[model samples]
Target: MAGSTPNDQPTTTPEIPDHVLRVHRRLVEAGHRSLLAGGAVRDHLLGLPPKDFDLATSAIPEVVDALFEKTVLVGAQFGVVRIIEPEGEVEVATFRADIGIADGRRPETVRFTDEKEDALRRDFTINGMFWDIDAEQVVDHVGGRKDLQLKIIRAIGEPRERFQEDRLRMMRAIRFSTILQFPIEPETWDAVVAEAKFIDDVSGERIRDELERIIMSPHRLAGYHLLSDSGLMQCILPEIEQMRDVMQPPQFHPEGDVFVHTGLVLSHLSEPSFTLAMGALLHDVGKPGTFEDAEDRIRFHGHDELGATISEQICDRLRLSRQQTERIVYLVRRHLVFMNLPQMRIARRYRVFEEDGFEELLELCRVDCLGSHADMSLYETCLGMWNEWKERAPSRDPLIQGRDLIQMGMTPGPEIGSMLEALEDARRESEVVDRDAAIAWVQARLDGRQ
Candidate 1:
């Protein structure tokens, strides 16, 4: 049933290029009925480039194996096979209807069925539609094409029953809303809010992966809003929700409460690396713990250090890699270093800049300050001073190495290590240049200490 228009102008159906269409044609020519399915069709209709193409066919796993030169019957019992081709590989699954998902995951038994039966069991309405490559018409038994046009995300059947089969779909609804920038239909949203607690049945790794995508979305704020409204935030990330009413001082954080401040920072974020984003989110988590009100003003004493500890535990629980955990924790702990900038000398400034990934730390600082004050003067001042230092006295290797100190009548011990570090600091500060000047500076320090 190809689409028709008056005057035979050939209503242009978006063409699937020869390469991909040929793959489907090969399967059909082998006497197997096939249709392009899932995200590829959804993306095509949305005018977005699809990441991968998937297919559903009436061909049994054995027939699929014989037709393609390369195929893997990894889940043959469930009617799925991986078809390999020179250009790309696509997943071709025989139409399946699932049964008995009592554990909130995995179908107890999968029965081979017609395409219509398979479509009925899918999670969302829009993702249930399929495209007929030969007829050039979409097969929409679930009114999915209409839902897509309406920009609605609705469950396929009784929302509660669909969600009961896989609890993770609750979060997936939030993710789709964020990714597609579409509204979750009222009934669907209410069902999600009611069943949000079932998300605990899902694995932490799966939950973390979905949460990361939500945070990275362009509409992160909206996603978070949905997460809270649907009660998913309380189950997944209660620490964030705790910031809601916790107030900060009026002088520095005139923006509002801790949650408001955090949201503002998130909104300003522009595709930062994952570690940076996580760090930014958790940077002030310890503020609530360290909050104190007294005579002069409010204070979150040592919150930077405290937040680092909290971040470590959270990252570990979430199973982050050691290096990733360390980087995020470092950012959280050292975020307040810029506040001490006025007291630090040029040498101290050089030391701070010399730390690993110092530029990213500076950017984190920018986000921190702006979220509270919307004032970047301090950040800009530091950047300007750093640039000035680089221009006037570019960094270089110290003229005096540890070996030089050892040769200069200094024993090879802790004293020599200390002298070598002091010499490097002097060089960074332009206080000393050559070996002679370094020796003189070290001697002055040692003699003064004595």
Candidate 2:
């Protein structure tokens, strides 16, 4: 009777997954109360397809294991289990109340409890409601429905206490506000500012994950502003914070300071990849330190090179993969090279496009232009060249190899590599189009050295 769907129908019926419905039915038939909970319920109510289904119930861990055919004790000690089915995996957590949070991340202990106690222990109100599959209603014990209606993100209870329980909640609050396009309740936002520094207590990996989600979200610029406004940026990414107030030449960057320029560039990204997003965010990171009030105009001499070094350090701190670090660093280093495109010879342009992640580099340049002066002249030229190049036959295979140099009576050493590089350059420029021509060119250079 406790799990039975109410006879009356609700205005909006959640498109519950068939597998989830089966599991819910099974648990109910077994006399254990079960309800769909957490983000699934929130998303459903908002008319978005739920990401995943999580079940909360009165049944304890052991009883849940007995009722389900395939059960994984993912967090058994904490009253959580994973029920795997052909359709999908549903995380089933027992109703429990958190006791104490000693580490600022997890509760030191938890006690099994009823629905109200469980709902009260959650971080945000909108994430605290449950959908009663049996009752055809949303069971809101913490005013979650009211908050949802107002499009506000409010902590479940005392804001400070909730944040103190998990310092990462500060970032989560910002993320939810950005993603949902909802404003944080004033008190909750104030708590975020007050507890911003404590966010350092969270692990770098967790913080990085949260930041990545914010970067990938459609409202990334909003998230960026919230992070800055909340003071979390200073604690987690002071490099970015330092960009604040750093002036760029107005002629080149009509977008105010480096920080404003960076935000505008980020906003213009179309289908951002993580590396490209990070590169755009930190492209001019060195401007603050390199800022110079020159006689002619503002100058950030060598900012690109300095920014690359700084970006690598930041990547290391965030524990990004070696590959990701290298690509991001490449972007930062080469972002300025596009200005030299017109001066470069055809071979030089080919070499530039041959480098790894050249497409992303071009994309960063386009956004950088759009964000600043709205000039696309250079971007259009480069794109035209790239398109024309793509239509041509692929660059022919190198006409010579290191082994060829050795066979040509050259010593197997650094000079061999040097010769090969010179030959390739010639080949790229079409000066040497055949194997015999490549050999003849190399011989001529050697004879000249003599």
Candidate 3:
């Protein structure tokens, strides 16, 4: 999930791959003016390699289908078709103008139109340019080239109308600003702020995906600040807004407030995976719910566990994949284990090293500390111990297995799992020295329970 740095400066546009150029030529040769459209044109001008290329043409979907050997009419209503080749595929869509509906993204009506009309209907000026295939120049009907040159994110036409046609455009605006590291135009920013609440009209999956892009970017912390400033954070993640101004005991957290501390944690991360980023953001999420001022210090009695539950609910709301949610929750729940780890028994420490997500957990621990007290003693210790056992112990054959337990007269059930955990813990401590000893120890425990 860590992000890579993009190109330093805009360069000459990338040469069109032969297969892609073929589609453009075919459309043009047939007298249907085709030009490279949307992000590809924008990225080319920016010197970033566009992931995929799309074409906008005067031809309709049916004409495109008839022209190409391998074609799929992905959206006949919108006049879009995919041209497949041995190398890859290109999406060729008819030039069209659209009207945004109030409730959802589907345009009220789509009319096949010309290049100028299509460019005017787009979301952002930077993305509204088209590459003139024959003329070797950019066709900027909506001042896209100027906006891109100035490094500003500006809506194509009326800002409100552009966002209202599709609410997801609001999130996309934030995403582009954050990723491109460009400031939003004043009017566009206001429109996003005024219509931030409509983000909910977009589906959870769509929101999740766009949010993922923002969270995954290196400038994500800035993205969050923008989200908060623009009021989008409240509609999308009110839980984060809850952390605003929550006080921490100054002795431990010299950082100003909960939100500031979380931002610091986010800043400390470099190329963080999605799980790490989420864990950092939600690490102290439960502080508000569990905060208590006792005689001695401010306490969050069970904030770690509580934060885990709350994070799960948040993840479910965002429609995160089950695996991503589980790992994130694990990091939040066990983040405090490091403070107690120094006092823990050797076996317990080793067990921590052996946990499934130990590496990510350790990272969470390091950042959590860096964000707060700036302590590294515990992290250094854990890293040392883990390094010592790095070659052995963690992967050492379990002194026993389920089948071995069954052979010793233990049935296949939940208790077998329990026994294995206990046996492994004892084995790590050398309390059970070998396979025979492990079997004997478990047999005795089973006998005692019986």
Candidate 4:
């Protein structure tokens, strides 16, 4: 869906929320000038209601800090102060120009300047525009408002210079394009592809965060295609790139290639958590290696196993927490198991529920199937049975303890422990209906052996 566009006629204007307008007016009344800035302006021009709002001002950090009851010097050197109101928090930054960036992440130095320089220094044209609340006018220092109407993502200044200032912006361009459903202008896209390798200099945490946004965005498939097209995926996650053109059997997949199948799966995801999205994206990572040409058709033997291993390595490289890495690997490894859901016995279904990381495994399989052939009979059957078993079989303490077995003329050895476990399994499986039956079943087995 396209975002809402701002009113075009000079006399026609949409009503700004009273609270936000009052906040803007209050800043001006306190002898400080403020402009509704950054994303709010971008969202407004796109006719979208912004989720969060920020402000830019000509007031210096110390000056603005004294007026607000709650203020934080979020970027003091750059004249940025965070104002906390009961309703919300707003960032007010003094107009400034960056000196140069020694580190790719932060400005080496910042000097307070006019709005023009500040707008120019920003990453993208659409994000550079400002709304001057006091004057009730929109500021288009970089023609951002125009660019927004064009449905294009263009760098504020020279694409190369802007990328050099902060490498992560290259990824942001793709993200904004995906979020806005806008096309990245040719020059901007080329710049991102050319400098794609510099994305390595960015911290893993930052890159991971951007990746999560791209994968979780509504247009995740388009985002992935952009990443692949821009060559960023090759630099950041070559493992995903490896899936391209790897064929799957037409009998099952009919989806042509592994990459296309994966992309379809990503498109099917809805508000997927970080782990689920990443798991879906990497679920078939092993397909390339496992693909083999057979007499009748192609096959990917044990791709799930190898994909799990690859998922582990990728997570480790990204420095994810051990728990997260393990969960993702588990999900990838078991994604294909849903195919066996219908044939599983009730006891085995409950056992699947009890397995470590079972819930995540189920979700991965769900999206995987939904993305592919869209035939979900197996998933529906398995999930239904699994839920039914769980609901009916609330766990109860076992009837036959090892001590009980030992007291019944069984030795205190592996046999006793084994018998107790067997009884417990039988109870869970409904093979032994009651506590007495469980004990009798164990006794019968022991008696038979004797």
Candidate 5:
């Protein structure tokens, strides 16, 4: 069966990339039924440019290996072979019906089957369809086309049974539903909520990836709500879930609780990067634990520092890259520093702009303000400082070295480094113009200390 694009334009066999098409054609001409399968077929009908064009074929791994000049057995046991063409790589997987999945990660055993059976064994209906390239039709044994048209995310078979095969599919369901802005079919939604606890059985890295996808999506607010509603948030990231209903100082955060503030921060962000989004999401992660009813008002006195530590742990648990963890943690810890930046000295304030992830910090600061109090006064002051610094763009390097301080009667120990820092600050403040002036300034500083 063939369907139409979102615009109701009649759609036929999906047109894959030329390199991938050659592989499909070769597999079909070899008497094996090869079809463009999975996301490529689904996206074609949705009038969107698909990311990858993977193929499914009736040919076994051995047959696929023999047919291609340059082939790689990516997953032979599962009947998947990679055909390396001149233009690109195509993964031509043999139709497989998985058996028992004891680990909930992969099939314990698989039986090579036809396209229809393979489609039926897939996780979701929207991803179970295939396009018969030569026949110019779709092979949808699971009613995937209809479900796609209905704007729904439904499992191929029994929703629970499908989820039981791979627990990560539960998160994936939310990811797909959130990204596509589609509602999960009733049975699928029920199964997800019921089996939410099983998500822990999935590896931390797997959960991290899915969670990253959700948080990084433009519809992250909706995804966050879905995760909380589906109970996955409690299992995967209880640290964040704890933020719910944590009250803040009404004078500063009249918007609502910590959870509401977080959602507002995330929603206000536009096209945020992974680090920025993660930074925004976990910026206040410490508020729940640090919440205190002080004599004056609600106070999360050291929430920034605590949140940074917690953010690091969460990032480490998720197996995030070391660099990204460092940056996100930096954002979390220093998020509140801008509140007092305007009061700092010229060099003291401008030096912050020179550090790594400063721009993102500035953006995070803006979004933070947008989420809370709508007070951009401090953010604007910092922005003006940043702009002034950019226009001047003073030397990031120090005007003088430790040796210069040593020559000015400063000892070789910690004071030399301090003097060098002071020298850079003076240079940034235009208090010291050149090497001569820097030397004099350091000499004067030593004289004053003495």
Candidate 6:
């Protein structure tokens, strides 16, 4: 619902994009009441640059389409239309009161109504405010202005009823709280905890999208903690919950438990890629399952190998793409390689360098060390070696092709692949520098085999 605040004024006027203003003006001129709504108004009040502008209007979807030169009926059935202009697109939703939410996601029926009814149906107070484009004033039908001032995320109406209407709002509340560095109102937070389990009822794609936003946020650690506290993490990622009291070898990890260590690592990540962040969170996921208490010391003998398998399963459950899953799994599997850096042979080192996503693997190792013992000796050594490898241009074109081997009267079989792999390993280590040398080396191996 869009209305003008009678007494309040914007501290700093936000530069409304041209397209949004045009749409609002056109709608108003056509005898429809239109105003900037939702997050755009919230952002403007906060003096932060808004990402996108959305308009709430008395005009129905058909009128919006008729008024705009180009319009997309993005959600026409729900009284939403996108006005496309040369500058950008603005979403204009007709003011409506939702009747029922049988699906727990969208309204089964919406009644076109005035601003107050529309404002009452929104999720949170901070998101329900509007800015009257014509009057140059702020609207606060749901006490949104006060909530924004207090830095609190409060549900617009009965918290339980609002959450029951849309389970994803539970995740969204956490996201907004963390991203804005605000606290959820006591009642709202309580309701979130009460309804956290219902989050699993939402689609995996929606869950994944929300999870990605939380993980990618600058305050991701805070978001993770909120998820855990609110019980949402248990429903979405129960494996992470299992890490709570999983003991680590104290000598190596003075940071208490696996969960604490992961949280610490997450804190150290500065401008992390999504894969790197997920890797940090799940790197030690195998420790809880493989914990061994021996007289010698605590040991997670093959946690890296097992963690990779677990990561793949998690990725598959989350419906991540094959490429994303592989990269994340690769990071989990190879996070421990830094420990072997000094002992690795030239061929092994070359092979490590040639693997995809080596940079991110190193970053994960660095943060992992930081989170644990804070001893960066291995990380530093690996980084230095990686730099040297980069300076030397370590990667080289294959000295010989499989077709060349087939052309040389050798039978095409598993032996061909084996021979090629061995030759490539030698070439990576600079044992053979040219095609002729590679041929001779293969011939010598074949001769020895004979």
Quote each prediction's TM-score.
0.88, 0.92, 0.91, 0.85, 0.94, 0.93
Kindly give the number of clashing pairs for every candidate. Answer: 0, 3, 1, 3, 0, 1
How good is model 2 by TM-score? 0.92
lDDT of 5: 0.88
lDDT of 4 at 171: 90
**lDDT of candidate 3 over 70-89, digit per residue (tens):** 98888878778999999999
lDDT for model 4 comes to: 0.82
**Can you tell me which runs of candidate 1 are displaced by over 4 Å?**
1-22, 72-74, 86-88, 389-410, 432-450
Sort all candidates by lDDT, best to worst: 2, 5, 6, 3, 4, 1
Candidate 5 per-residue C-alpha lDDT over 273-326 given as tens digits, one digit per residue, 9 for 90 to 100: 899999999999999988899999999989999999999999988899999999
Give candidate 1's whole-model lDDT.
0.81
Q: Estimate, for each residue in 1-450, the C-alpha lDDT of model 1 and write its tens digit.
A: 123234312244546656567668988998888998887777767767666678899988888888878877878887889877777777889998988885786788888899999999888987897888888777777877777778889999989888998888888899999989899999999999899988889887778788788888877878878888899988877777887877888888999988888877777777877788788888888888888886888888998898899899878766788888998899999988888875798778888878876777888888888888878888888888777776776556667777776665678889887777767777877888776887788767656752
- Lowest lDDT 10-residue stretch of candidate 3: 1-10
Residue 177, candidate 2: C-alpha displacement in angstroms: 1.2
lDDT by candidate, in order shown: 0.81, 0.89, 0.86, 0.82, 0.88, 0.88
Q: Top model by TM-score, which number?
A: 5
Error in Å for residue 164 of model 2: 0.9
Candidate 3 wrongly placed segments (more than 4 Å): 1-11, 100-102, 409-418, 431-450
Q: What is the Cα root-mean-square deviation between model 3 and the actual structure?
A: 4.0
